[model samples]
Target: MIYLDANATTAASEEVRRAVLAAMQDGFGNPSSVHIRGTNARQTITNARDEVCLLIRGALPEGVTLTSGGTEANNIVLRGIPEAIIVTTSVEHPSVLRPAEAAAEHRVVPVLVDGRADPQAIAEALPASGDVIVSVQWANSETGVIQPVEDIVTTVRSRRPDVFVHIDAAQAIGRIPVHMDGIDALTFSGHKLHAPQGTGALVLGDPEETRLKAQILGGGQEGGRRSGTQNVPGAVGLGVAFRERAKAFDEATGALRAMRDAFEAAVLSAVPGMRVNGGSSPRVPNTSNILFPGIDAMALVALLDQRDIACSVGAACSSGRPEPSHVLLAMGLSEDDAYSSVRFSFSVMNTMDEALSAADIIAETVGKMR
Candidate 1:
């Protein structure tokens, strides 16, 4: 099968799998236990933490806290920061939106398309006395649009020095350069970058300043930011994946962009009334969301699946729903346009030939439906 769903999750790399197996078989002791076996597990976790910190060029290991995935990391930030005014874009992942929705006391500032949270909008939304926690994603999952996070961080810090900026970099971390210079905290998922599932991390600039309250209560782990026995195997695997990917990011990204661009051009030429969503903005290298007018996205997805080409209607977390894409809707697409959107996300494993074949199949399927 030709897999095009990297935005949803990626297959774990061989190196990562090896690392996981080694940890599970030999390093089976509980990190919290005081015995030598436990000490070995604790050291493994610490080594993993240092590797993750290096991925983002973070200075200290104490600021990085491992979590189940991006959702938990986002929740910890939203619920942990008390009474802080929350600012985020309308097009954020549900992970960010849902937690903010649950925090009834916090004020939420909505960012617009053009794929940016306007600094002025944030400035206008801030209250006088309370602290602010601005959550914005570095790269959108569906459209691959890259938000101006550096600019947002600069604006928020200059305008409201007390504000803490948390970036959901689940889609950006290993795929692109993540300079943590201005960011207060950043979240990332392992599965998004060829590591095992159920693994992710939150990197903080100042843990004391933006102290995260524990979302899951139990045995103290992750510096008490998240409580549970450490997933030593998963953590080790994630660290290996990130360190390997960081070495070849630029080359892999270039290949992905080339494939995406070629597929998009072919699709536009082969089919009429096909619009590229977020084409005007700066997007990540590996994704393209295309709209095939008069075609049902769900139907198209099934058709492509029959041809052994895997893709998605939108974010995988919400694909099972019947509703139109919230991301497209936030970008002002009509219900029909939103329903017609299909997202194709590439990965390092995909070849240029496979990309061309996928485009041909897509064009053929759309033609038959039309």
Candidate 2:
């Protein structure tokens, strides 16, 4: 099978798998217990926290709170800051967009056709009182378009120092450069970075000032920000994955970009009227969303699946629903155009040959259908 669904989830790296096994076999005790075994488990968790902190250049270890995944991290931020007005883009993942909708007071900023959030539009959406919480994704998951986060954060801070900024960097962490310098909080998932599923983290700039009210109140783990028995094995695996990716990020990015560009060129050349979504924007090297003008995305997805070439129509969470992509709609795509969009995401394991082959298959299929 040719797997082109990295945006949905990635296969865990060998290094990460080894770390997980080591933790499960030797570090099985509850981290909260007082025994020596427990102490070892607690230390392992701490070391993992340090690795994540290092990845984002966060201030201290205490600011990182491990969660199940990106959804939980987004939920914590959205529910924790209820009183604050939420200013977010409409192109965000459902994890971020759903919570924004539930917030009592919120504003949804529009993204340009290039799939980038405008810093000026975000600035315009800011609340008059300056009591706002701005949430934007570092890179869009489906389109791979990178947002102007640093500019938005800097502009917002200059205008309102007290405003809280939360970034959902689930797709950005391992694929692109992530700096925690001015960011108040950032969220990333383990599976997206080759760690096991059900593992993620939320890094806060000021644990005291931006103290998240416990989304899941119970055993009081994760410094009262999250509660439950910590997943030591999962955390350890995530740390190993992050470290391995960090060591080879630049090389991996370059290779992925070459494959992506080649794939785009092949498809566009063979299939006329085929528009590469978000091609004009600065995107992460691993993802590409394309519009096959006269073909239905769902039908194309089924055809690809039959040939064992796995891809997606949009966000994995919203795949089964028979509806137009909200992200494309936000970027001014017509409902018909949005419904015709398909996303192809790459990973470190994919080769240029595989990408070229996939493009050939896609072009042939589109030709027959059109």
Candidate 3:
């Protein structure tokens, strides 16, 4: 099968799998226990924490805490922050968007047609007078467009020194450069990299400066910020994944971009009216969302799946729902245009040869529809 849905989930690397297996077999003791095996499990989580912090570049090891995945990390930040106004973008993942909507007072800033959140809009959305949490995705999941995180954080700081900033970097970490210098909190998932699905982390800037009360009250774990028995196996896998991803990072990203760009060029050349969503924005190297106007996207997906070429219509969590994409609608696309869009995401493991072959298959399949 030619899998093109890396944005949904990536296959765990063999090394990560082995690490997880070893952790499950030998590091099974509860990290909270005071025994040799327990100490080893705690050490494993600490190593993973350090790896995650290193990946974010300037994030503190004291600030990184393991979570179930990006969704939990996002929830912990949004729900745990001091009661204040919540501000987020219209095109954020539902994890960020939904929690912001449930806030006592909140603002949803609109995005440009390229699906990038405007720093100016977010700055303007800042509450008149009070502590606030400004949350934005470091990069969009559906369109793969990078957000102006540094600009937004600067804007928020200018508004209020105490105002907090959170970035959901589920798709950005391990795939691109992510600096945690000004970010108050950031979220990333293991499955987006070459690790298993059950692992993720939330990297903090300064816990004392931006205090977070735990929402998950249980046996004190994760420095008492997050509580539960840590998933040692998943943590081990995540540590291995990040450590491995950092090696030859530039080469991996560049090659992925080359293949993605080539596939996009091929698709645009061979298919009529093929407009790429967020085509003008600075996107991550490995994702492309294409619009096959005047054709049903689900039909194209079905055709692609028949030949074992897997892609996606939009976010994995929102699959099986026939509604138009919220991200596209936020970017001013018509419902018809939004419904007709399909996303092709790649990973380092996907070969350029298969990419070109997939392009040929996509063009041939889409041509028949047209």
Candidate 4:
């Protein structure tokens, strides 16, 4: 199948698979133990931490706490700071929105028609006196719209430098360059970057300064930030995946952008009433969310699947719901328009030929439906 739903998840590469297997066989001891095998496993985790920290330039290795995935990593920042007034955008993933709203007092900042949160809006949402946490997604999973994180951080900090800025970089991490400057905490998922599922990290800009409360309590593991027996194999695989991407960053991103642009151009030319959802905005290279007005997105997705092509209506986590996408609605689209949108995300494994073929098939399928 032509898998174009990478924003949901990516298939692990052979190298990452091998790394996980090797770690499972050789580094099977608990990192908390003092035995020789345990010491070796501890060293393995430490090495993985260094690799992950390197991916997010200027990050401190000690501040990187491995988690189950992006959801948990995001929760560690959102729910962990209960004392702060959580300020987040309306278009954020459910992981960030749900926990932030669960707080005693929180503000939901609205986004522009382009699916971008205005930095000024976020700054205005902050109170004048108490501690505040501003959480935002670096790149949206549905539209691939990239938020001006540095600009948002600067605007918020100018109002209140102590305002903690947390970024959900699950869609941005390996696909784009990630820097930790002026960002308090950043979360990324391994499955989004060609690594195995159930692996992710939350890197604190200054763990001591933030002093975030622990969510999962027990064993005093992960420096007491998270308590559990470390998943050594997952960590090893994630490190390997990041290392591989780092080695070929420019080449891979360049190819992905080319493939996406080619596919979008072909589809738009062949299909009428089609437009890119966030075409004018800065976006990650591997995503294309298109609006097909008057057409049901789920119907198109199923028709494409029948033809051995894969795509999605919106976030995989929110699939099968009868309601329209929150992200699209926040962008000012009507219910009918929102229901007619589809997200086609790509990965390094996808090729230019596959993209073009998918475009032709998509145009043909839409024509038949019309």
Candidate 5:
């Protein structure tokens, strides 16, 4: 099958799988234990932390707190500081949007039709006084449109330097260039980068200065940020994934972009009136969210799956709900248009031949459906 659902999750690389196996066999002891086996497990986690920090470019290794996944990491930031006024965009993933909505005080900044949050709007959303945290997604999951993270940081800092900036980089980490120089807290997932599932991290700029508090309390693990017996194998697997991707970043970026562009060109040329959802925006190279004017996205997804090709309508977490995509709706798409959109996300594992074939199949299928 040709898997075009990288945004949902990526297949773990062979190296990562092997590393996980070795970790499970040789590093089975609890990270908190004091024995030799335990020291090895602790060192495994430490090495993963270093790799993760290196991948993000200038992230604090001491501030890296491994979590179950992006959802948990996001919750730690959104819910950790309840008293701080939460400022976030409407186009963020449900993980960020849901918790931010639950905050006692929050400001949901609107996005443009291109699916980008306005830096000025975000800056204006900040209060004149009191603590605040402005959270934004580095890249959108469905459309792959990249937010102006540096612009937001600069604008927010101009108004309030004390206002913390957090980024949910689940879709951006391995796929694009992400700098942690200005970001206060950045979260990324392992499964998104060909690592084992149930692995992720929250990298803080300054763990001491951030108002982030621990949501999960236990034996004071993760420096009291997230307390639990760490997943040693998963961390090792994630480290391998990060290190391998970092080495091949340039090649992977070009390959994924080429595949996505080729696929979109073929499909759009063949299918009259077909349009890319965020075509005009600055997006990550691996994603294409297309609008098939008058088709049911779920039905199309099923048809593609039947043909041994995989894609999706929206975020995996919100699939099967029979609702239009919130990301599309926030970008001013009508409910019908939102329901008619499908996301085709690529990975380095995909081939140009597969992209062309998928485009042909999609064009023919859409014609038959119409």
Candidate 6:
């Protein structure tokens, strides 16, 4: 199968797979225990923290709290901040948007016509008073629209020193250069970066500085921020995956971008009335969202699946929802336009040949529909 649904999840690398297996066999001891094997397991988790922290350059290793996955990591941050004016985008992943709904006052910064977050709009959305919390995705999972996180953070921080800025970097971590500098907190998922699932991290500036409340409380793990036994095997795999990606991020992104451009060019030439969503914005290298105005994306997705091409209409986390994508809707697309969009996210594993072949399949199917 030509797996283009990388924004959903990536297949674990062979090295990561081996690391997971090795840990599962000999690293089963609980990190909270003091026994020799447990001590070794604790060390393994610590090592993983160091490697994972490297992905978020300049982030304090001590402030990184491992969680079950991105959802829990997002929940930890969104729910932890209490009684604050939450400024986020209407296009955010459901993990961030749902929790923000219960905040003091949730303000949504609408995406621009090109489907990218407007730093100015986010800055304008900040309240004139009270504690403000800003959370924006580093790179959109669906359209791959790169948000001006540093600009947004600067706008909010310069407006007020106390405004907490959080970035959901699940789609940006390993594929792009992520710096934790101005960002108060950041989140990433293991499965999105060629690591095993059930592993994710929430990196904050400083545990003591944030005075972050514990969301899951019990054994006082993750420095009492998150309470549970660490998934040593998954952590080991995640660390290996991060280290592997760190060595060749730029080169891989270059190739992915070339491949994406070729595929997009071919598909656009072959199909009529096809619009490239987020084409005007700076996006990550390996993603493309195409709008087929008269086509049903969910139906097209199924047809593509029949031909062994895996993709999605929007966030995999919320695929079963009956309505159109909130991301496209926030970008000022009509409900029909939103439903007509399909997100084709790529990874290093996808090659130029595969992308071109997939493009042909897409064009043929879309042409038939047209």
Clash number for candidate 3 = 0
List model 2 lDDT by residue over 105-162, tens digit each.
8899888889898898898888879357899999998899999998998887887777
lDDT against true structure, model 2: 0.87
Q: What is the total number of backbone clashes in candidate 2?
A: 0
The C-alpha TM-scores of every prediction are 0.95, 0.96, 0.97, 0.98, 0.97, 0.96
- Tell me the tens digit of each residue's lDDT in model 1 across 1-370: 9999999999998899999999999999999999999999999998988888766865467888988899988888888876666777788899998887777555555546555567677666666667667888899998988988777777777777877788999998876788678778889899988989999988888766535567788877877778889999999998898888878878888998999999999999989889999888889899899989889999999999999999999644445567888889888888899999999999888999999999999999999998
Better of 1 and 2 by TM-score: 2
Tens digits of per-residue lDDT, candidate 4, 1-370, equal 9999999999999999999999988889999999999999999999999889767888988989999999999999888877888999989999999998899888998899998988998999999988788999999999999999989999999999888899999999888899998999999899999989999999999867545899999999998999999999999998999899888989989999999999999999999779999899999999999999899999999999999999988543446456788999999999899999999999999999999999999999999888
The reply for model 6, stretches above 4 Å from the true place, is 315-321
lDDT tens digits, residue span 305-336, model 6: 99999998864444656577888888888998
Evaluate residue 271 in candidate 6 and report its C-alpha lDDT on the 0 to 100 scale.
92
Tell me the tens digit of each residue's lDDT in model 3 across 177-223: 99887888989889999999989988888855446778798888888
Error of 5 at 220 (Å): 1.0
Alpha-carbon local distance difference test for all models: 0.85, 0.87, 0.88, 0.92, 0.92, 0.87
**lDDT of candidate 3 at residue 355, scale 0 to 100:** 94
Q: Is candidate 1 or candidate 3 better by lDDT?
A: 3
Looking at candidate 4, the ten consecutive residues that score lowest on lDDT are 314-323
Runs off by more than 4 Å, candidate 4: 315-320
RMSD of 4: 1.3
* Candidate 5 lDDT tens digits, 1-370: 9999999999999999999999888789999999999898899999999999767887877989999999999999988877988999998988898898888898999999999999999999999999898999999999999998989999999999988889999999988888887888999899999999999999998867547878999999999999999999999999999999999999999999999999999999999999999899999999999999999999999999999999999644435467888899999999999989999999989999999999999999999999
